[model samples]
Target: MQITNEHNEKMAKMTFSSVYPHYVAKVESKGRTKEELHQVIAWLTGFDDQKVKELIDEKATFDTFFKKAELNPNAELITGVICGYRIEEIDNPLTRKVRYLDKLVDELAKGRKMEKILRKA
Candidate 1:
């Protein structure tokens, strides 16, 4: 599907809480822990465990979720394809943030080491 403005809008409006469970399930199924998943999330968006839980409890949309985030400076280093789109090539900033999280979760589920998944200088 073409990632038009409407598609970006739809993605931005997607509830982070609705997708959080699936992320937990995915990682756990692959023998990864929820703590590991949270670590990845913290590395990307700087949301602590408590804040994440609050967001989940409130069912915050991606828009609200990211707006509250102090995105990591290393986030732009998260490059690669996820969900068939090259994350670095994604023009919409919010959509890219969402995909960056997806990519981190994917890497965690795939057994990538934390050091590699959490990019650094």
Candidate 2:
């Protein structure tokens, strides 16, 4: 699927806290804890618990949230389909990164092992 600038802009403008409840619900409904959600996000974005809370409290946009992140070195290892788009095939760097987080949360909801989800060595 072709990812357009308009879609990217829309996603960029979305507030992290606004979307966070859905993410929490997605995993918590499947018996996952909020801390696990935080772990996966931290692994993907290199944000500590406090920093993640700060972003949520500030109601940061996806652009602001990711801009302040130190993305993990293994982020490139995240690959596969998310919302019908293949992670490895996404051409827009920012969209790909956003989708990577989406995919990670999807996997967490699907009960993927924490070590694998975090792309641990």
Candidate 3:
């Protein structure tokens, strides 16, 4: 897919729920943690939902998604999104669990709103 600035905006706004499954499968099958998966996606596809899905659906055996980023330049922007954060900052368990639950919903009914699941309770 194309990697325009508008595309980057859309990716940055993508709720974790919409993109979590690809990472979940990778994490489970490859022994990578949540952060590791995100980092890989960030490095490879720049956070475009469609490209990330394509990469995951390919079942690449690499630890991170950097193996074939050239196939999707959109993933390059995803790397910028993750430039300085530590893995713990993004691997929020509570938020991740909520995303997993959202995954159960049908695509037509799924909420794309990015709620602050990591609230300071």
Candidate 4:
């Protein structure tokens, strides 16, 4: 569920009102700061801080996150797309499930890969 540079570019062009919540969701779910989210947008879409802030202030939605996160066809990559520290790997079924869900939430927060995370399931 890798997001291509092209997809990231497309996301950057979306309206702020239409994309803000997604930004909020992504950052909040992953327990990341606005700065961290900014880094992710810069890494994945090449957007600067100003642009990332605009989106954060807009009316973001689940759809917006879905588009920005690029969930489809790149789910696998989401789990590995380092945020702050490395995503911890869980092997216990209960812990694994919880960790898996947390990781998925983290990825989706930024419109990330879902398949790689799913593979672990």
Candidate 5:
């Protein structure tokens, strides 16, 4: 799918806090705990639980959230389609990061194993 500049701008301005609840609901609806979701996030973004809460509290936009993140080296290992776009093919860095997290959460909600979700070797 072609990602437009407008799409990138919309995603960049989206708040992590706004998305966090949806992530929680998605996982929980699939029998995954919030902790598992947090674990997946921490694996990719290196934000511990407390830091995640703080980010949510601050309403950090995707741009700000990613800027503050120390993304995992293994994050590059996350690949495949999410939101109708290939994670590996997204050219905008911020949009790609957002989709990486989305794909991980999708996997979590789909009952993929935690190790696999964490991109374990």
Candidate 6:
């Protein structure tokens, strides 16, 4: 399904903190470490562990969270299917960014190698 602006706006208003635990649980359930989850987030958004925690503590919305992000130049390298949607086919910029994070977390939970997940240079 194509992502609509309404969907993007709704997702943008969602709290990153509210969604963080699910990401953590998904990875941990698959035997991955919280550190690995943080690593992927940091690699994608340029927020270190401390900054990530601070954003969570502040209850930052996805819009606010991504607004502060310095997305990696290699973010374009993140390509795959997520929730039945192809990442490269997503048209909404914000939704694409959100899906990028989702795809990364999914990859981490699925035990994809860190180098591959990070799209190593």
Q: Pick the candidate with the highest TM-score.
A: 5
Off by over 4 Å in 5: none
Model 3: clashing residue pairs?
A: 45-74, 45-75, 46-75, 46-78
TM for candidate 2 is 0.96
The TM-score obtained by model 1 is 0.96
lDDT of each: 0.93, 0.92, 0.37, 0.45, 0.94, 0.93
Q: What tens digits encode model 1's per-residue C-alpha lDDT throughout 1-121? A: 3589998999988999999999999999999999999999998889999999999999999999999999999899999899999998898999999999999999999999889999853
Regions of model 6 farther than 4 Å from truth = none
lDDT of 5 by residue, 2-121 (tens): 999999999999999999999999999999999999899898889999999999999999999999999999898989999899999999999999999999999999999998898786
Q: List clashing residue pairs in candidate 2.
A: none
In order of TM-score, best first, we have 5, 1, 6, 2, 4, 3
Instruction: Score residue 81 of candidate 2 by CA lDDT.
Output: 96
Give the runs in model 2 whose Cα sits over 4 Å from its true position: none
What's the number of clashes in each of the models? 0, 0, 4, 16, 0, 0
Instruction: Give per-residue CA lDDT, model 3, range 17-69, as digits (tens).
Output: 44567646644555445554444444333555566666557654232333344
Cα RMSDs of all predictions?
1.1, 0.9, 15.1, 12.9, 0.6, 0.9
Quantify how close model 4 is to the true structure by its C-alpha RMSD in Å. 12.9
lDDT of 2 by residue, 1-121 (tens): 8888899899889999999999999999999999999999999899988998999999999999999988989999999999999899988777888899999999999999999999887
Candidate 5: count the clashes.
0
Give, for candidate 4, the lowest lDDT window spanning 10 residues: 90-99
Each model's TM-score?
0.96, 0.96, 0.26, 0.33, 0.98, 0.96
Best by lDDT: 5
Which regions of candidate 3 fall more than 4 Å away from where they truly are? 33-121
> Residues 1-121, candidate 6, lDDT per residue (tens digit)?
7777788789899999999999999999999999999999999999999999999999999999999999999999999899888999988777889999999999999989999999985
Q: Model 1: C-alpha RMSD to truth?
A: 1.1
